[model samples]
Structure formats: C-alpha cells, structure tokens
Target: MATILYARVSTSEQTLSHQQTQAEAAGFTFDHVLADHGVSGVAVKMKDRPEGRRLFDMLRPGDTLVVRWVDRLGRNYEDVTDTIREFMRRGVTIRTIINGMVFDGQAKDPMSAAVRDALVGFMAAMAQAQAEATKEAQKAGIAAAKAKGGEEGGVYRGRKPSFTADQVAAVRDLLGKGLGVAEVSRSTGLSRQTIYRIKDDPAGASKALEVWA
Candidate 1:
C-alpha cells in the first residue's frame, strides 16, 4: 500500500519538479516517486514509456498513485481513460494534485460508478485537448523564434541547457553503468530529459558557447 508519485518531464527546463513540491505542500506525501523525462506526454503512451511501464509493475492493490493531473496519465482520451480504469480495477486509488481529486473503484453503487466514469471521461477529454493545444502553441512559438532569428545580426541562439558539464559527465557515467534514466535523475539531481539528452548526444548537448562566437 505505498503512495507513489508519477511525473513526466518533457525537457530539462520544464517545471515538472513542482508537481512533487506542490503535492507535498498540499499535505500529500509519497513513499516513492517515478518520473519519465524528455518524453512527450502528447505523443507517447504511458505504457510504452520506460518509467511508465515500471509504474504499472510497481503499483499493487491498495497502493495510491498521485499525479499532477489526469493528463500525466496519457494524452489520448481513450488511452487515459483505459489506464485509469485499469488502475482502479486493480484496487489502486488515483489522485490528482490540481483539484486534489480522487477516483476510486470502491463504490459499488451504480450511480456512484456512473458518476465516477463520467468524471474520468471528462478529465481525459480535457487532457487530450490540453495536449493538442500545447502542440499548436509550440509550433507558433517556434515560428516566432525563427522569424526573430532571421533578422540581421540575430543568430538563431538555442535555449541554454539546464545541466552543467560536470552534471553531464556524471549522467554519462551513470548511463554507462546501466542505470536507468529515472534512477539517474533521482540520484544526480539532473532531470531525466537532461540525462537523456546527454545520453543521446553528449557533444551536441554540451553547453558550449558557440552560437555566434
């Protein structure tokens, strides 16, 4: 009956860490936390993600799973609803930080079940809508950035990385030792995305000052 928090970080600079902080501040405590980094919640299915599969395996009957929101479960409405229903079927209690909401399967009454299902569907739809909105916003932002970059003397300066050289090296070392990205993030204070960026392309991800000289 452990209380676990699952979070997803799409990039190193993302504020996913605040999910945990906010939960704690809201008087919620977790015995463990599982996170997936550098992974798009919009595109990736929860079960396919590295840490996400781990979560499915680790949780047991009577355990509580806490997420910042239902969207963290998945982006697709069908996928999110299915996952939540499966968890509830397993006697797992799912909670959200945004509204401090809980979805439980303990209610045997037909009306209670109907209400729960309806609410779950609503949340899942919202999650899917949010994901689509985010993708559109990202496309607009990139277009804007490109327009600015093309201006005279305006080099296309990329966003600065959040990790340091030493941190990158440490992450590389950990990956070399076969440590999983989530574990590395927990052990090194580096976001899973940052660690994966280093793992995928150490040289490219280096924080070298080589934008425009």
Candidate 2:
C-alpha cells in the first residue's frame, strides 16, 4: 500500500527533479520513486521497459501509482488505455500530476464509471497524438539544421558541470547506497540530472571537473 512515483527521464529540459517538484507542488508525496532514464516513452511500451516492468510486480492492491501524466504510462493510445484499465482492475489507484486526475475501479455508479472510462480513452488518444506530433517536429528540426550548415566550432564540448570533485564523490557514495535520484538530489543539494550524469559516468565526470578547473 505504498505510494510510488514512476518517471521517465528522456528530455534535457525536463529531468527527474522537475517531475518530482511538479508532483510535490501538486501536494503529492511518495514513499518510493522509480525512474527509467534515457528511455523513449514515445517509442517503448511501458511494460517492456526495465523499471516499468517492476511497477507491475511491485504494485499491490490499495497501492497508489503516480506519474507525471497519462503519456508517461505508455507509448501509444492502446498501451496507455490497457495499462490503466489493468491497474484499476487490480484495485490500484492511478494519479496524474497534470490535472490531478484520479482513476479508480471501485466506483459503483454506472454514470461515474462511464465518465472515468471516457476520460481514460480521451487522455490516451491525446497522449498518442502528442507523441506523434513531437516526433514529426524533431524530424523537421533535424532537416532544417542540416540545410543550414554543419557545426561552426569543430566539436562542441558541453557546458561545465555543476558539481565539484568533492560533490561528485558524495554523489557516488549516495548512489552506491541504492538511493533514488530524487533522494540523492535532496541529500547532496545537487540537481537530479547531475546526479544521473555522475551515476552513469563517475570517472568521466571527475575528468570533466578537472578539465574545467
């Protein structure tokens, strides 16, 4: 009966911390959080993903599943609708941070049931449509960039990382303890994305710090 937050961190603009903050701002708190980094929510089915599969086995009746939105639950309309219905059938409450939408299967009234099901279908359709649109937009952006020219400055080394050498060590320590990204972010006063970068490549992060210094 634990409240779990499941997030997919793929975009550079919206990292795991942003999702956690958004959920917190909506007055939602979780006992545990699971995230899948670098996984495309638009292309991959939820159950096929690593942490996504864990959500199926880890969640029990009376437990609550929180996501940033319906789109975070699946890759397509059918997938999202099916996942939500299955969870509701198992008496698991699903919540969205976007509009504070709640889907429960315990409703005895037919009218309430109809409304809930309708909303689910509509949101799932919208999620699929949104994913398609985003894909097309990315394609266009790439085409436009190619038409313009190649990189002006040979190879671009990204901006300097936010963490110091000591901070990187601290991040590694917390990560070794199996702490969640959000928890590590809070404990070390570092951004969740930074923690993720370090977790993925500790030595490279250390080298980057030295190079910038």
Candidate 3:
C-alpha cells in the first residue's frame, strides 16, 4: 500500500529533488524515493541500474509506483512497454505525473485494455524515438566540432591537458550517459570548456594526454 517515487537523473536540470518536487506538485505523495544519478534512460535498462533494480525489489503488490513520466521506467520502446506490463501484472499500480495516467491492470473491458496497451506502446515508442533523435544530434555536433578542430591543424600538439587519465575516463563515462557539459564538469571537477573539448573530440583529448606523457 506504500507509494514510491522513482527518478532517473542524467542532466544538470533533472535533479532527483526536482523530480520529487514535481511529483509532489502534482499531488502525489510517496513513502520512499529512489533515484539513479547520471544514468541515461536511453542507454541503460532499469533492471540494470543499481537503484532501479532496488526499485523492482522494493515494490510489492498493491504498492504504487510514481514517476514524472513513462520514460523513467526504461531505456527504450520495448523496455518501457515490457516493464510497465510486468509491473501491472504484479498488481503494482503505475502512475505518471505528467498525464496523471494510471495503469493498474483494472480494465474491465477488452477495448479499454486494448486502448491502454496502445497508449503504452505509443508513449514508449515516442520516448525511444526522442532518445535516438537526441543521440543523433549530439553525434552530428561532435562530428562538426571534430572536423573544425582538424581543419585548424593536424599534427600540432596543444598544451598539456589539465585533467588526469582518471578524470578523462570519468568525463567520457558521464558524457556517454548524455550529461550536459555543465553537469559533467561539476561531476568531474573540470571546467566547462574542458568538458566541451572532451565532448567534441574525445580521441583528441586522450591523445593530448598520451603526447604529453
């Protein structure tokens, strides 16, 4: 009978507290809060994330799971739909704050059930499509930046990087999770400009470290 709030935070703007506040503003109260920080909803399945896995185990029949949106439940279309259906099957009510949508496996008629299922599929597909579009946009930006860098010069070794190898690795990992430059900079204690450089040409950043060493 408990209610839990789950959040997936990947950017500077989408803090866990921010999500909790959004849910509260929507008039949903939760007994517990769970979050996965710096985790990409597009790249990592919920079951694979540390807190996400805990969420699966913590929730029981009759418990309500609340999220800002359906996208918080999974990495993509199939994952989102399957996870929701599985939760519904478990008798755990799934609620989204955005549309105040509820999926409780309580449809009395086949038409209602079909409509619900269709909506779930549509939302999941949209979530995945949005993720893909963002990723592609990022890739295009990186390519353009890298090309510009190459045009500036090819063999000219720049100044030594301020980041250590570990810092570089952390930057890459955070970037891979789709974190913005400011968020990645804050996480790694690096400057925004350095993070942007890494984001633009990660290989070049690594090469700088190698050439300096």
Candidate 4:
C-alpha cells in the first residue's frame, strides 16, 4: 500500500504544483503523483481520464489517496460519492486537502461512520453544486458577450499555450531520424523531457499536439 496524490487542472496553463505543495504541507508523502492536465471535472468523469484510470489500477488495500478537493473526484454528487465509496470498499483511504477531510472504510463505530458518511455526502454535494454554478456563470458570460457583439469575450484572453503541434512533430521527426532527445530539444526549443515523451508514445504525442494546437 502506498500514498498517492492525484492533482487535476482544467487547463494546461494551470500547474499542479500548487496543489502538490498543499498536500505536502499537510504532511502527506506521496509515493506516486497522478495528474490530469487540460481535463475539466465538469465534463470529464474521474474514472474516465487517462491518469485517473491508472490511479484506480495502482491503488491497493491500505493505500491512501489524496486530492485537492472532493471536486477532483467528480462534478456530480452521485459520481463523487460512488467513486469514494468504491475506493473505500476496496480498503483504500480517501483524504482531501481542503478542510483536511478524511474518509475511511475502517470506521467501525456506528456514530462515527454515520458522521463520516454525512460529511462526505455534504461535501460531495457542495462540490457538484459549485461546479454547476461555475458552468452556469460561464454560459451567462458567453450569452452576455454575444449580446454585446462578442466585445467582452474578445477582451478576455484565454489560457496560455503549453505546447504546439509543429513543435511536437519536429521532435518526432528528429527522434525518428535517430537524433538524441537532447539534440531534438536544442533544434526545436522544446525540453528534453517533452522530446522523450514524444519518442516514448508517438500516438499519444500526436493526440496531445492536435488537441493543444
């Protein structure tokens, strides 16, 4: 059993470092860190993400799972509860950075169990509600922008670009030509880590490039 940290951000522009720092500051030492970038909790289920799947597979009995909040589990009340319960049933402990919430299946006392369950239910519901409100607010903003002839929307610059397709492709071509990752990085101005990733999984690299591009 291990201690695992799962961090997620809706956009690539947002880094997981902040969440990681919080978890570490809270005295959690993660043996593994799973992160999902550019994946929205409002639109994506926890078990559906690439990194999320690995979290489920890697977690074991007696292991502890940490997230920034209950929202990281899901954007819906039922979904969050179901996911948390499933992990608990498997003997995995769940903890959240916010409020230092802890949920474990090992709570044997009836009152303690009830209190924990109720807290989970309340927090999960609030997470879902917050996500819904955020979605509604975004829609309202978009509608208001349209009414204003897209002027307001145009004024709001979106997330910063993390990677580009041409850069990825250049790295791929260099790797295919037997160039070292460091050499590819020097040529394309991308990091050696990015080049190694492209070399390791060209298909996934292509998909990321397409989505980000």
Candidate 5:
C-alpha cells in the first residue's frame, strides 16, 4: 500500500509546498503528494477541484491518505463526511497530523460504523463552521477598517488589493481580446473565480482598485 499525502490551501494562509514542508518536518514521508492551491474551502467542493478529483480517482484499496488536518480534506459537512465514508468503504485509510487521528477500514460492525460516522459528521461540521467563521471575521474586520478610515481620517480603503492596477488591466485586456476565464486565469496566474468576478463586474473591480490605490 502506498502512502499518499494530500495538501490543499486557500488564499488565506496555506500553500502546497509550505504544507509539504510542514508534513516533512512533522516526520511523515509519502510515496506521492497531491495539491490543490488557491482553492477556497468555502466555495469550492473537494470533488470539483482538479487535484481533488485526481486524488479521488487515484486512491485505491489499501492506500493510505495523509493530510495536515481534516479541513484539507474538505470544508463542507456533507461533502467531507461523504468523501471520508467513501474512502473508508474503499479500504483507504485516512490519517491527520493535527490530532494524529486515524480512520481506517476496520469499522465493519454496525455499532463501529455508527460511531465512526458520528465522529466524521462532527469533525466535518466543525471544519465547515471554522471556514464560515473565518469568512465572517474577515468581513467584519474589513467593515471595521472601512468605518475607521485611514490615519488621516479620509475615506478608508478597506484592505489592499491582491492584484495591481496593471494586473487588473492585463486581465481586462485579455478579456477584451476574448480569452476565456480559464485561459485568462492560466495566463495571469489568477484564480478562476477571481477572473469571473473581474469579468462579471469590471466597473466595480476598477472602482475598488482605485480606492485601494
């Protein structure tokens, strides 16, 4: 059985390489590493992501999957729990580094299965709650910053924009040239959702960029 490490990161903090380094530092070795980067846990379902889908197809019975935490596996309660149960059904073992949790295929009896499912459900709910809580906190922080304004007491620029004016311009230019959102994201290194947001509301995006600038 091969040990595969799956890593995922939303734009907030984690990165693929960074996760791998941390796992290694924690002394976990793996035969393969899969990553999904810049994918939002709240918005993107695990099954929909590229690497996530690949990991789903690649894993087989007797394979062991490792992750930094249950959150990396998924953030939606339903999806997370379903995915874990499916993996367990397929004889795949799921392990987490955070709590050193091990969920294996040993749960054959009904009672054992019920207990395992309950635990999975609880963790899945917690993961989704944490993701939502983080989003709410960020929104509140931005709102507070906007209300407080700058040090000079002028209009508050909520937060700095991740993309520069030139980058936004580049995206717009590519869009004007009729490039698809996926292609634009590939060429500009921006997330597909970000491309769609800019594409859908160019005026609003431009206005925000100007305010932040």
Candidate 6:
C-alpha cells in the first residue's frame, strides 16, 4: 500500500539525489527510500547488497517498488528477470521511472500478460548485453593502460567509497557495542537510516568496509 523508491550510485562521487529528484518528478512519493552507495550493479546482485537485502525484507504485497530502470534490479538478464518476476509473483507492483514502465502480476487478460512477459524478457536481455559491453570496454581500457605502462591501468578506477576506513571502523565499533542505530548515527555523522542498514547486515557492512580499504 506504500510507494518505495530504491536508488543506487556506483560511487560516492555519484549522487543519488539526482535519481531522487527524477523519482519525485515522476510523481512517486516514497514512503521508504533505500540506496546502495559505492555498490556496483555489475558486481553486486540485488539480494547481496546491504540496503538491497533489506528491501526484500521490507517490501510487501500491494506496495509499489520503483527503480530508475530494470538494470537497477540486476546487472544481467537472468538476475534482472528473475528478481522482477519474483516480486511480481509476491504481489508487489514494480515500476520503472526511466521509461514509465509498470509491471503487475495481477493482470487478468491473457494478451496483456503476454505482452508484459515479452517486454520483461527483452529488457532483461538488454541488461545482460549492456553489462557484457561494459566489461569489454573495461578490459580494453586496461589493455591500453598496460601498453602505456602500469601507471594508469594497474589500479581499477572503480566506484568510490561513501565512508573512509576510519569512519567505517568507528561505525562498526558503535554497532558492536549494541548502540541503537539512531544513537550510532547521532554519535557518528552518518545518517540514522544508513546506521540501521549497517546494524541489520553487519557482514555486508564488513565486506563494504573491505572494499573501501
């Protein structure tokens, strides 16, 4: 019965605020907002992310799940389709603001259902193709870097971390001390919502911290 907006930025340098602004412009009032900062859609599956996992637990039947695109659900075809279909089967309505596309499992008409299914398949395939292309591009870039010497190509110039190592360690310490998320947020400068996410999935938070390091 509520509208939820899920936004993701591959790096800390990238802002989810732009995505939020777009979602708001699309007339979606988010009752809950979940985001994954410094998380790559290509490497992290929806179910594997910190906030992403929480989303699966929080979404309910009749709730509207909005994302920037189908790609936000996954990095490839199979993952994207499977995730969306699973949500639909659970009676959750899925919508994409980018294309103004809506998918619902409650459709009773056979023809409409067929069309929707086909569209999902197409989008899923496109997502996979896009990922493949990006991988190839990265490989090519690395090769070029190697040719020029290890100066540019040795390090993967990937997503930037939202928090520094020191900050992450502090967050972990506060969480380990069993401080409430709100209290942890107040103690640290991080948002209370983000603190709740770290508390909910300490393992994922640890992995994220490793990535930061």
Per-model RMSD to reference = 3.5, 5.6, 7.0, 6.2, 3.8, 5.6
User: How many pairs of residues collide in model 1?
Assistant: 0
For candidate 2, lDDT tens digit of each residue in 1-213?
A: 899999988655777788999999998889999888766676788898788999999989999999999877866888888999999999999999998899989889999899999999999999888888988998887666655545553333345778898889888888889998879889999866677788878888988877677
Give the runs in model 2 whose Cα sits over 4 Å from its true position.
150-213
TM-score of each: 0.78, 0.69, 0.73, 0.71, 0.79, 0.70
Q: After superposition, how far is residue 105 of candidate 2 from its true place, in Å?
A: 0.2
Model 3 whole-model lDDT (C-alpha atoms): 0.84
Total colliding residue pairs, candidate 4: 0
Stretches of candidate 5 above 4 Å error?
150-153, 169-205
What does candidate 4's lDDT look like per residue over 1-213, in tens digits? 899999876643356788899889989898999887656676678798878899889989999999989887777788788889989999999999988878989889999889989998998889889988978999888777666756655433233334577787787777889996558878998654455556667787766555554
Q: Candidate 6 on 1-213: residue-level lDDT in tens? A: 888888876643456788889899988898998887656677678899888899899888999999998877777676778888888988999999988999989878999889999999999888778879988998898777666656645544334445556666788898888886657778888765456456556676667667556
Candidate 3, residues 1-213, lDDT tens digits: the string is 999999987655567778999999999887999887666787788899888899889888999999989887865888799889988999889999998988888888999999999999998998898888988998887777768779987534456688888999999998889887779878999766567667768898889999888
- The C-alpha stretches of model 4 lying farther than 4 A from their native spots are 150-213
Error of model 1, residue 65, in angstroms? 1.2
Between prediction 3 and prediction 6, the one with superior lDDT is 3
Model 6 alpha-carbon miss at residue 59, Å: 1.6
Give the lowest summed-lDDT range of ten residues in model 4. Answer: 153-162
Task: Kindly indicate the candidate among 1 and 6 with the higher TM-score.
Answer: 1
lDDT of each: 0.84, 0.84, 0.84, 0.79, 0.83, 0.78
Q: What's the CA error at residue 174 for candidate 2, in Å?
A: 19
Cα displacement (angstroms), candidate 4, residue 210, comes to 16
